[model samples]
Each structure stands twice: as C-alpha cells, then as structure tokens.
Target: MIHMAVTPKDRSHIRTYKTAKQAWERLEKLFLGNESIQSSRFEEVNNAANNFVMLEGETAEEVHRRLTALALQLTELGATFADDAWIKRKFFTALLPYEEMKSGARESRELIRLLWPTETLPTDLANLIKWLETAPDRFIDWKESAARAGADMALSFVLSWYDEVNLDQLECRRADVEENLPAENKTARLARACAIADFVDKRVFIEDPNPPSDDEEELEDEEIEMESPPPAVDPAGPPPAGA
Candidate 1:
C-alpha cells in the first residue's frame, strides 16, 4: 500500500456535484474565491482548482483527455517561464513542421520579416556579428544577473546556431553569444540592441546639420535641394560592447 501526502486545503476542496455543469460552477466559484489568496503554496491551489475543473466536465474518459492536454500546455508554459530559450526555440520549433509543406518556410519567413523587419536575417545577423566583436563576456561578468534576468540557455544556444550557420564564422563573438540565444531571447536582446543603436546612430554618430552657407541661401532661392550626409561611425565605433 502507498500513502500520499495531502494538504488540508486540498482535502477541504474535494467536492462532488450531481451534474457536470454544477461541478463546473463550483470549480469556477472556488477558483474565483481564492484568486487573491497568494502564497508560496500556489502549486497546491492550482492543482486543486484544475482537478475540480476536470471533474466538472464531460465523461470521465473525456475529462482525462482534456486534463492531459491542459497539463501539456501548462508544462510548456512552465518551461518557457523558466528559460528564455524554451520560448524562443518553441517558436522556431512551431515553424519547423511546416518547413516542408509547400513553401511553408518561405511564408513563415516572409511573415516574420514583416512583423520584425529589423531583427530578420542577413541584416540582423550582420549587425549581431558587429556587436559581438566588442561586447563584454556576459558569462563571466553576469552569470548571476543572467540567471536572475531569466535569460535562457536555450535562447543563447539558438542564437549561436544562427551565428554559426549564417556567418560561417568559427570563433564566438559578443554578437555570437547573442545569436546563440534562442529566437525569443534573441528578439528581446536585439530589440534592446536596436534601440541603443538607433540612439547612438541618431545622437552620437549622425553629423550635425551644416550651418546654411551664404551660397545655400542663394541655392534655396534657386530651388536647389541639398541632401544631408549619412550618420558617422564613432572613431572607436559602436558601443563598448555587451554579452
């Protein structure tokens, strides 16, 4: 015989309803009743809530199936919460099965490109390489911070794969580390990087407008348009760098 440990709350919540609908109603009420009650023991409360919801639905067999699906979805969410890479990889994984389905990769790639043009391949990959060339070694400098930041190892791994495959570069760079991050994680990091890049590009790098020359006034009168020069790279180039 096996004995299992049960919490007092769990025991108390164990209830039976004559009809499935009644059980569902009770389940909803119980969940709503305790939602504000936060505690470290959240898992226990969640389990009870879920169990009650299952019991209130369909036939026992169907209940089991629904519960299993719910469990799987929760597990995926849990993994994603724990690691950034999981979420990132999950996105790429979702796109994988369709890769062979009659230009599925093309369609997905196009959609993603439109959705996140700045972070899309070729361009993003090129910038990442430039970033890694100088960014500090985050693994050495930010081990604790990275973990606390919820940065996922899987995300790093995915980015690295991108760097390795895309640039065909063997050595790891700061951008390489970024690339090694999973797709989702890379998106976050890249968004940050892009923001910084834009700021630097606009404020620090872009040349100040030239004061209008006496000739310029004459040119303007003549309707001769002058184009501004592109932004300048710093003598040392982009930011100091980061992992």
Candidate 2:
C-alpha cells in the first residue's frame, strides 16, 4: 500500500470570502472534519456580514476587518492583527478587485461627470481616473516589472480613489442607514435617500416664477388705461368732425 501526504489546513484559506456568508460556507467546509464549532452561530456571523456588505454598502475588507477585530476583541480566536497578512491575502485581495471594478462603475454618474467635467476636474481626481483607466498597461515598459504588478496597479487605482474620496466613510454612512432599518424594512433605503437628496437639490434652484402670467399682465395694462386721464377730446374733436 502506498501512503500519500496530506496538506494541512492553514489560516490563509479560511479568510477568502467576499461576504461573511461566503466565508461561513468555506469555514463550514474546512471544519467539517474537525470537532470544534459547537453551534450555528459561526454560520450566523457570516450571514450577518453578508447582509452588512450587500445592504449597508460595507466593503468586504471592512467586514473582514470587523470580524477579525471582533474575534480578537472577544478572544474568540487566537488570531491577532499581527497575523493579518493572511487576511489581506485571502479577503482584501479578492474583495478589492471587485471593489475597484465597482469604484470604476460608480464614476459613471452622468450628472456628477457633467457638473464636474473631467476637462476641468481637479488635477488630483483627474489624474487618478486617468491612471485608473489606463492601468498597468501604460507602465508596461517600466524596467523589471513583476508579473503581479498589474494587479498592484489595479489596487492602486482603486485605493487612490478610496483614499482621496474617502469611500469607506461614505460606506460607513450607508451602513448607518441600513442599521436603522429592520432587515425586512431596509429595502432601498440607500436609493431612497439618494433620490430625496437629488430632488431637494433640484428644488433649490429658483426659476423665474413662470414669467408672471400673461392674464395678470393684461389686467394690469387695462388698469393703467383706466387710470390715465382722458384725452382733451371734447371741443377739438367736435370741431374736426364738423369740418
């Protein structure tokens, strides 16, 4: 009989989820052969994290960081921030690529693009978008570039937008809105807020009040005609008619 060597499970593999749900599924699979995990709470956290990301606009990285932090905070796991490299590798790497794509998509807000044209956009934001659009291809000729540098380029493009625009902060606000609503009632809260804000913004612009209705102007003209003194008609007009 031939004996085969088996690969040991590592922390690196446990953190590859885009949402907590995904992570939970992977964790369940990983722990299937082990005796730990007394109940379904492990799975529940993953589900909550997924909900947080989907409805709250929280990034997977944020969720992963939160989960890891909570774990360490409560001492649920031996994992510490010091060993976060694996978390970054498994979660952020996978999540950021998706986030970068999303960030790029978000830049397509037509009104914002029109109101803040790229031709006149602040140098920092314009340059950032340009680099993002061109990506590592523009830097292909650089000397001794590594194979994975292109991914770094994508990450840099997204990170630059996030850092400069503070997308995480916006996401935190989005999360707040989601938090205030019950799961059943959280439907479209983000969209509704955006819509209401946009509507109010449009309403702020005062139009010329419909140019003062034509009927009102005509009535004012009639009033002025009646108010003016009658022409010296009498004596001169009778004499001209007789002639």
Candidate 3:
C-alpha cells in the first residue's frame, strides 16, 4: 500500500526501507499524512496547504473558521504544523492575490510588523483576528481619501469633455486626492467589502451587521383554496335542512 501511495519520484527513497511501516514513515516525511489515512487524504492536505489564501471578500472570522477547518483536516490526515506559531504565520500571509489587494497586503504586512516587531508574523492568530475586526478607526481618514479618489474616478467616466487641458487638470486633482488615500481606491474597497457590508468590511474585516443566519430555514408556503361560500344562501329564504 505504501509503495502504491508514494509518488513515483519518492519510490527510490522508500524502496530501500524494507518494511511497509518504514516506507509509510518516509512517505509521511515527504508530505503530510499517516499510515492510517487513505492515500487520497494525504494528497488532499498537501494540495490544501499549497492553495490556502484569503478569498477576496472573506471576513476575519471567516478566515479563522477556514483555518480551523483546515487544521482539523490536517489532524484527521495525520499531519500538523511544526508549531502554533507556524499556523499563525500562515494566517498572516494569506492575503488575496489581486492588483488592488497588493497595496493592502503590504500595509497589512507592515501592521503585522508593528504588532510583532519580528521577522515573522509572531502574534497569536486570535489576537490578530481581533485587531483586524476592531481596527476601523485606523482606516477612517484613509477611507475618506479613497472616497475622494473614487469620486474622481466616477466623474471621469461620464466626462463629455476630455480635452487635453481638462484631462491634465483632472489628473492633477486626482493625484492630489489620492495623496492621502490608502493603498487601494474606493471601488477596490467596495469590491473587497461586497454589497451589504460595503466599505465597512473593507475598512474592517468583521461580520456583517445583519449577517444571514444559517439556522433560519426558509419555509415553503402552502397554497390554500377557499371553499365557495355555501351556495350563496338567499338573504330572506333560509335553506330547508331542518330549519
């Protein structure tokens, strides 16, 4: 089974192990898994680790939950982080990969520096998520600046006059507006936050004010037919049923 489980490239190393247990142990060293886990689970953990990253609109809590789920998967697969700090470090670096997020990613890294003042992101994951959720004030002025730039971008789109001089002046004004803006513009922030949360999520990664409840199942409505009123009883004449 171990022979079949190991990748072709790993065969050379495991072939000489002389026992299935030894071969499995070598396979564990090569990637994340245990003899107990089926070979597919072993491959899954490695793939998950390599692909782990913050999705564009995910909140801090969502990220934490995702990490927890991933950690559990690793445990089930008989793998583990070298240390708690290693998990935290992975959480810190899982920024979304997009041009707009690049600036935010750099800022986030710098903030991690101030929080840890270390070569690696050394803060506990819980503390980091708490700060991410609660740090709205830090983004206020920068958000306003982004709003300014966003306003400029919106106005520029509807321009009937795109003369060289007007364009030049507008460009200069945009530059001024962006001087104090955060790494990303308003539209990017909006995209990051998504519809209902809007800039709030972008400014601070947290649960939405009125997040949808998973427990609230939508009940299907049943259609009811009203019985026709009893044969339109005459106003004056009563029906004879023992009347």
Candidate 4:
C-alpha cells in the first residue's frame, strides 16, 4: 500500500530502506525537513508585515488584502496570534503614517462609519473590501476632505502620522449629540452597535491585500531563484586551475 501511495520517483527511496519502519522514518525526515523550510518561508512573509505601508495611490482595501495574505500565510504555518482583534490591530498599525483613527470605537467600526455611514457594515473582511470598492463617491468625498484639511500644518501632521480624520473636535461634538438623544433613541443605538459587532465577529481577519496573478507569481518565482545563493559544489570533485 505504501509503495502504491508514493510517486514513481519516490519508490526508489522506499526500496533503498530494508524495512518498512526504515522507509517510514526516512520519508518522515524528508517531509519534516521540507516543513521546516516552509516554516522559515512563513517567517519571511511575517517579516514583510513590518515593511507594509499604504502606498500613495493604494486604497485601504488593497492594503488590507496584501496584509491579509501575509496573515493567512502565518496561520497556515501553524503560527497563531492572540485573536482576530490582534490581527485587525496589526493590519491597522501596518498602515503606517496613517495613525489610528481618533474614534474611540474599534478600528473596523470606525472605518465602516468613515466609508459608509448609512449602510450596515459587513462583519467579514472580504465584504468590507467589497464595500469600499463599490463606493467611489464616498471615497471622493473622503479624499477631498483629507486634501482640504491637509492644508493646515497641525492637521496635516496629524493626518499623515496618525492617519486620522481632521474632524476639529468631532469626538466632543459626538458626545454632545449623544447627550441630547432621547432615551429610546439611545437604546436603539446601543442595540445597533451590538448587532454590528455580532454580525462582524467583533472583527474579521484580513486576507490577501493583493493576491498575485499567475504571471506575477512566475515573475516573483524567477526573482526569488535569481536572488537565492548557488548550491555548494563537492570539495573532492573538480578544481579549476589558475587561468
């Protein structure tokens, strides 16, 4: 059965072992070694998280997708972080120069309110990306607001470093509005917030920000091979004489 299970090329390796146990041990070593190498590869992908930043022309969805891919890779490699909240936090932080939005609410909720205040914010990461992609008008307004407010030195600095909206004391204003809300309205608002959290699993795990196409993958693979060190040659083999 084992012989039948292995590929033809691997059959020779099995035959070289005298007993089934030996063959199994050898196979384990080979596969285990490959897994170790893959773990190192995951570490490389995780290291990439440190370098992630929202590019000038890129949307938040694009950035989220890219970071999601890295996070997924980490998960696949048996590396687990604290929770989805941590993953969401990591991605938010990774969007460097765009400091966390000033809303005391969770980042995802704040993002939802920023992009689509009227609609129900989807709890899933993919859905959120879809939502952002579909709303060009909202994005235009967002960009314009940023540009207009960005002219002020203090606002510009805050927007660039914290990546927060220049709301001009929006938090205080929000408190004032909440304070004036009727008792029934406030209860409804609290219920809505709870529903949103429940709908979105507190926060969704981000996935590949920019999944590569086949052609891109090929190019990346070629680049990786080119960058890799050449294999060591046998010391006892041939030696080149002085030219």
In candidate 4, stretches whose alpha carbon ends up further than 4 angstroms from where it belongs are: 1-35, 99-243
Off by over 4 Å in 3: 1-37, 96-243
> What TM-score do all the candidates reach, one by one?
0.14, 0.22, 0.27, 0.27
lDDT of each residue in 106-197, candidate 2, tens digit only: 67443334433343443355665664565354344222233234333444556866666654464444547655678656556455544444
Model 4, range 1-243, lDDT digits (tens) per residue? 677889875675577677888988866754566767977777687677666677766777887787677775565455667247756887677665554432322575666676765667777657766765666866665565443333333344456777657576644555577778899998986776545434332122222445679999899989999999999989887776872
Please write out the lDDT profile of model 3 over residues 1-243, one tens digit for every residue: 777865675575577778888887766665654555566776787688767888867876787678766775565455656246756776776743543465665677677554334346525546555666644754553565455555544455447454344544655554566667776686785674443233232332232345445544222111112333446757888777877
lDDT of 4: 0.64
Off by over 4 Å in 1: 1-81, 104-243
Candidate 1 vs 3: which has more TM-score = 3
Clashes of 1: 17
The lDDT of each candidate is 0.44, 0.48, 0.58, 0.64
Q: Between candidates 2 and 3, name the one with more favorable TM-score.
A: 3
> Which ten-residue region of model 1 has the weakest summed lDDT?
199-208
